[model samples]
Target: MSLLASEDLAEGTHNVKQGLPDLLRNTHDVTSQWMEENTTKEETELNDWANLPHVVLENVFEQLNEVSLLRAQFVCKRWYDVIRHSASLWRDKSFRFSGRDPRDLTHGPYKYASSFTRTFGRYLERVEFKLFSPVTSSVCKKFQKCVKICLNSLIKTKAHLKDFSMPALQLDRSQWMLYREDMCSALARFFCKSQHTFERVDFPGTRANFDDGYKILYALGYNTGRTVTHLDITDMMISRRPMFDIPQFVECFKHFRCLQELELNYSYISEDLLEVLAANLQENSLQVLSTSVTQHDPHNQVIWGHSWAALANRCRDLKVEFYFQRVMTYEQHFRILLPQIPLSEASFDGCYFADRDWQIRPTIASILPRFQSTLERLIIELPDTREVFETELLSLLSLCPHLWYFKMSAYTSTRFLDKLLEAVSEKRCNLSVIKVRIYVRDYDTDHEEIDLERIYTKYRDLITNDLIDYYATCCVSM
Candidate 1:
């Protein structure tokens, strides 16, 4: 029955979703009547509203959402006292800081609730930083303050810290030298207190140089690593003067007894750790190992003959992802990316690294032969607007028979993309999505990024010669 006309709902509201909305429409009047009728003369005479059975008020409060439930506290002094004193009321209610600025936590919409958070935070499931870009060096100190504040409020009422995703902290060289160690210590305390029964652990954009993000990670690996199902540190970078080296990660990744999905960058994982990684895989766990092809110790180490077969034998679902950051020398790519390992995804960040000395880049022709059948997705990115692929990508479409998603991004040149549109029409390939990135000088103007989807998608034929010609003429100004 509809809410407006239903007598049954008004009398006996069964579901919380159905009852809460109508009840919220008249909070003062309904709650006043509840206080009046639900209490006895002896209890009501002395202003003893606390004597109104706990279960009766709890049933009503439990049906309400966070905002309504919080509002319910002001009905009486007893109501305020009950909510403030009781732990279970706020236990499962999440404390979320989805704002971009530190001021948002201090002075914005959450300003009113800051006191509430401070009062009964430990019972909260977890503190979450949501829907914000990684903070820069300038505001890293302020952001870290917000993080510490949020964590500090959570007084450990129970040893039931389920899952945790550390907030993004992208500090510059100067910020790292000054603020990183103190912030690390703060996070270390949080982990030490509530490090039990975690099922998912994620620390994105972690810089693993020195003792930067190491102490926090070591604390985690020390406790909940054996139980976490998904462990993601893919975007972590450790170039030089590393602290959490190969052997530490070997011991760390070893503790994941029930790990189903792991995302690790090459800097954290080495050739020596691959065997350990292989052995740790549960029956269905798939490892997405990342590599930046360079003349580094582990990047240049051979994996084809030794641990590659062992990984394939143990885990059929093993998928390796390549990130061609800066300079991708052929020596490292060929050495590790062997026939036995299933090469699922390949990404080109740039054609060359910062180092000026020119090294031989392995062509797609040479590097992809072994796992062409296994290849599912190929992404090519050119940081320089003028830069295009060293090798033509038109032939790459045919090389990988099982390729699903092909993306050419971060470049202004649409010439290769035009050729791809022309070729894919005639000779059918297995490509499901073709994503191309085009650049316009001004960031604000509305423009559609060219996405040539599956054969059946109506928009596939939309990218005609006429459209490409139109794009070429007006792309620069757009």
Candidate 2:
């Protein structure tokens, strides 16, 4: 009886132990499956585009164009909310009104001018006026009226007009003669009125008489002095009136306390004006200055080297560009000016360096040393006949430890490319980009058969294996 009872109890205990393992295994499997499903659901919710943060949606909307944004506003309620709340999307609004039709000027049933201003004008930070076919008197009158209406709308809307650009008034000789003064006065009034908030004013292809130019300058100096940071008066036709002297004209620059970039293409820059600029330029704010110099008689002209040197010294971050229309001996001028400025960027375009006395290497050498610590960008375009020395080029590059962007059009051999790579390695130069258009002599067979692909492969190897990152583009010319 005892043995039978003991055997039955042992069999019962073994059955319980075996069944417990299966029960625990089944419980673990169900728990794991539930956890995986919950995790997947959470991840899907997190990655859903509709659940993106408001700031992210705003940023996405900022990249959309006006037409795309207008269409996007109707996509859904959430998108509409994002577009409406995103201030960045409406920060720098611009309004354009083309004066191709006389009816555009009138406040007819369409209310073309006022409707645009009333709806979107409050957000405008820029205004552009494009008047076409201003040849006939009627068209000219309409254009002028449209401009007035636009200006009045801007004033009424109280939009912060930071950038203002106007195309040149196209008119026939008779039309120009009839309306030049009135147009000048109207433009002057607009500038004067909007000067307080204007940060950039571009009046390309505008022809102005001496009086008009003076008025523009006066408006800039007195009204917009503290706010205007960028000014482009490219292709402005100044009357050859003897009454408007350079000294009086340059007096306006003295008031430019906030001017960071000034471009005066095809404008007269006399020695007296340079002197005035040297004395009065906003050193802390003036970062870019570009002008064209046309000195037909280099001998009789007053030397501007000292003034330029002074300017360069005072404005350490200045990127001075001089576009010479006439080929003259500018070596002396550059020699004096380059050593004083810590040029962060320099561009010389259409400059003739084939002059007998133009010692390119020495002039560049003198300039490169001072620019070594700060120079980041350089662009030089020279005559194809001008020779470029490898040693001088290497020396110049070695000095620029922080040169990230380089562009040059010159006569250089293939050895220069090798030397450039070696220099970058030796100097530990952080060169992110290099673009060279080398005019190699046909007889110089050393680089005539150069495999650019092989060079690029080498560059890629350096990037991948050595962790040196840079992009280089080399083109050969004969």
Candidate 3:
């Protein structure tokens, strides 16, 4: 009995040892299978990324505008590195925002974008913000705070912006109860911000105080280490006395050492004021200057030979547009206007030379030769009432060689068209564009007209065949 029991124990031990090996092998197989599944998923994802086209990947990130591009620096390490180093990418994008209340907070589509902008502000190159009505003192303060937040957000990003634009804060006539002082204070703070990040500034029509405008100018001058290349000041409401009396316009401009173009158009500019302005430009880098004549200012009368000659000498290119108070005879007009036409480069707009007393043709013939060589563009606004000037007009065209653009809106008989064809043929005039609007209101209906198409065919070989770029017409019937 003892021998049989020992044999049974040995058999049981052998069975247990075999079972342990099987158990260990099964556990190892399950672990290995799980690891294989996980590794396969990782490899599949990597392969998908590798298969993506290069252009697709680049376009996905590079298609954003300037402001959104600036604000997107914080998206990830890859995006941050891309925008922080690329300046040329942001050159063509415009960045503008409004300064009004936010009435809604729905996270519809741009939740991710809005968050990005808040993260990195003012890396944007340009911004335009709108201001709504009911512009009260409290609303202005709130708007000021919003601007401060945006500015502070921008300052934190360490982005170097090159251009910025904003609208003037409009005043509500109904809300006279609003504090003017508060609004002025808000603007003062706003201008302080504007004095930075701009190389060229234009304010077309701002209903602000003259002092306020000058203050903004002062801030711009004080802040910028060097003056901008171009400055435009226009549409300010200045009376005859106060316009000439102010010295800030001339003095403030002297600060810009590199100013090249200055346009003082549609403003109440005086001859004495212009003289002061010209004196500042005497030896500076000023190249192109434009201004209009207003008859209200007695100081703006034609000291043409002196004032215009001085400016023509100072500027390499000049353009002057004068609105007429009364029509003058061609002889009288030429006396004042001809001397101002620069021999190098010049342009004239919105002037009339009408003479009822004597013949106007000879004076026009004499005056047209000055534009023969150097004039690039001529825009003449003709008198509404018409008189015969066909011979004079043909003579003028005969003198102009290498004329690029010619626009005429006046009365010209069909006889003048024949002369024009002859001049084009004889001179082989290399005209790029010709815009003619013949007033055909008072023509006789019974007469047979000259065929323009026939003339075109006669000189078809001689006519310059540069393909017409644009065409639109309003046909007139007699």
Candidate 4:
């Protein structure tokens, strides 16, 4: 009788478990039915996005890029109204050329990008105009007109512009001359108005006369010298023809007291200019200076050791990059410059040493003691077939306690891999990254051969065997 009772209890429990799903389904159905019937009005009220606070809508619009913003305006009358009134939506806007002819400003995305500034220029803090496609003379003129319009709007609104990028105008010497004066005047006006707030100015591919360039620089010196930190005047065509008297050009740098990074290309550097720079660099504020020597300049003077020493004394943490053509020799320059400058990073490219007897190993070894603590990055590119063994290079590495990055392109023997591993192990160098391009000759075949795979394998072994705690890459050049 007790076994039967236990079976009955089990049957009852099974029946209740089977009915549990039905009970839950009924409850859910009732609740959902009630919600459907009663909450329609509340749902409609909650769906009113237009009723959201203005600030919230502004934030949503800010996330949309320029193209999306144009489409977003057509959503409804209320959204259109929100977008029109929200001036902050246009702040920090960038206008990029989308491979369209600048003259066709009435059509395509350029129309919108160019015209938006007319309406919302007051709210702009940072404006960048990048011309990715090349422009014809007519298109450049039209582009200049648009820039002038934007500058006028900024001036009218009294907007404190922070960053400005001159379009990468790929104009020939003649085309540059056509619009140079007008652009310089407009830029000077803009700089005069926004000097206090300007931080970066990039002129990637633009040309001007020396007078126009001087006017622009004078405006920068008088107005934005202290405020502007990063200035790039690369590939600037000062004239249709070359002007060897770059001393006047160097005079403009005296006013850039607060500059952190300066880049100039296709310019002449003379001893007088170096002396001026040494005297005028505003309290050791300059950090990075990159310039290329004008090739075949009759007026090019040898940079004396004292001039470099004076500049180096003021700018202790300066990183110098000297780009030279085959016309100049680097050994004499480095001999004078390296010992004076407490450089953190240095790069020498396309430089040929006049003194055939001068070896890089000795020059580097001489400066290792002076630069050990400060030097972190070193790049040397010389294709000379001189063999540099591990033993000679290891001494230089041992002195550079803070060295983190090294790149060299030169000729070396098979023992270079073994020697590098040995140096990293023995000296305990702080090299975290290294890239080498070594040219090796197949002596038996009397031809150049580069076994990249073997070098990579050896580098991998160095890391795997705990010989170096860094990233290493090796390339072979034949």
Q: Report the Cα lDDT for candidate 1.
A: 0.59
What is the TM-score of each predicted model, taking all chains together? Answer: 0.63, 0.65, 0.64, 0.71
- Tell me the tens digit of each residue's lDDT in model 3 across 60-103: 54787646765776655556665665544544322222324344
- lDDT leader: 4
Clashing pairs in 2: none
User: Which digits, one per residue and each the tens of the lDDT, describe model 2 over residues 1-478?
Assistant: 7999999999999999999999999999999999999998997875575568999988888888978997988877878877765656766644343445556445451355446566566677876776655545655565566566667676676778788877665432455666667776767776676637888887766766667766777776787778889887755546554322456677777777777888775245556666666676666677887755444312233344566676667666677655544333446445334454445665555454355654456646665567687677766676444655568667777667777776767777556666676556555556656676666445544543454445655565454554334443434443
Where does candidate 1 clash, by residue pair?
Answer: 122-155, 326-352, 326-353, 327-353
What count of clashes does model 4 give? 0
Clashes of 1: 4
Compose the digit string of candidate 1's lDDT tens values, residues 323-360.
76654556556665677777888876665233433232
Which order, best to worst by TM-score? 4, 2, 3, 1
Best by TM-score: 4
Candidate 1: Cα lDDT at 244: 29
**Which clashing pairs does model 3 show?**
95-126, 95-127, 96-127, 96-128, 97-129
Model 2: residue 334 alpha-carbon error in angstroms: 4.0
The candidate 1 region of ten consecutive residues with least summed lDDT is 465-474
